[model samples]
Target: MMGLRGINRIVIAVRNLEAAKKLYADMLGATFHDAHWTGAPFGIHVSIAWDAGIELCAPMPGREHDSAVSQFLAHKGEGIVTVFFGVDDADVAVSRAISAGYACFHSLDYSQDEMDQHLGGRFCRYQESYVSSADRCGFGVALARIDRKPG
Candidate 1:
């Protein structure tokens, strides 16, 4: 069993990251970090607006066809791709989700060192698992556990 804290963030797949960020900022009065984050493994460029709990993602250049963001845009055309739930343990959440008959399609684990190098020590450990419940729930779900360093 896993205790889900709350909605961590809602990821939106978009054709243009900049335009989407601007749109979200204007619409929701959101503020996003100036520096964009790239998930090379997923082949997507990501931008997160912490205050609004929104994340915008787009396919990376030259990896458009192979990226999940691109595929989602091609099929659905810029919409909510995944809603992430905050959990105490992502692995436990994923296992529970699987036991409940959900299919997990992607997972990632980042260690403290990796987080320090990539995220500037803001986060210590980050783990996530994306579960597909689209057929039943009409949307994708993701479980995540993020450990932030103390200020």
Candidate 2:
């Protein structure tokens, strides 16, 4: 990616997806997309779009493992984990990230739940990465191009 975009999505690593969704959607004026069972060991993923769609991905509750998301909560103490970017080629973008020494979080299978949940019918595809640096605010998340609202 030549020019990177602003912070597109703020992924919150929370234990309670429903609680997070309630707070964000009801109190914080966040318009939620839809929830999905990621098929990962994790329980459910709720896509909440306020100004941006922040994916609230939580572990399946119990059956804890030394996974990256687990480490994220252990280290950063919840909030924003990964930053997504919509690039021309995910493979090429991933290659560039590899060259830049950035750890890439591979693409999610596919979720159309968001469109089904939202009243306005907004949709988007998110790709992200996490760069570790103990000194710089614990860690840093960067989002590239956020392709949304469809063509």
Q: Positional deviation of 120 in candidate 2, in angstroms?
A: 10
lDDT per residue as tens, model 2, 5-46: 444666677767678778887776876765553325444355
Per-residue error (Å), model 1, residue 122 = 1.8
Give candidate 2 regions above 4 Å deviation.
Answer: 39-44, 64-68, 86-92, 103-105, 108-137, 140-146, 149-151
Tens digits of per-residue lDDT for model 1, 1-151: 5888899899888888889888999999998763344466788888888789888888888878998677678888889988989999888898899999998998889877777776667787789988988778767898999867788
The lowest-lDDT stretch of 10 consecutive residues in candidate 1 is 32-41
Cα deviation of 128, candidate 1, in Å: 0.6
Report lDDT (Cα) of residue 130, candidate 1.
Answer: 84
lDDT of 1: 0.83
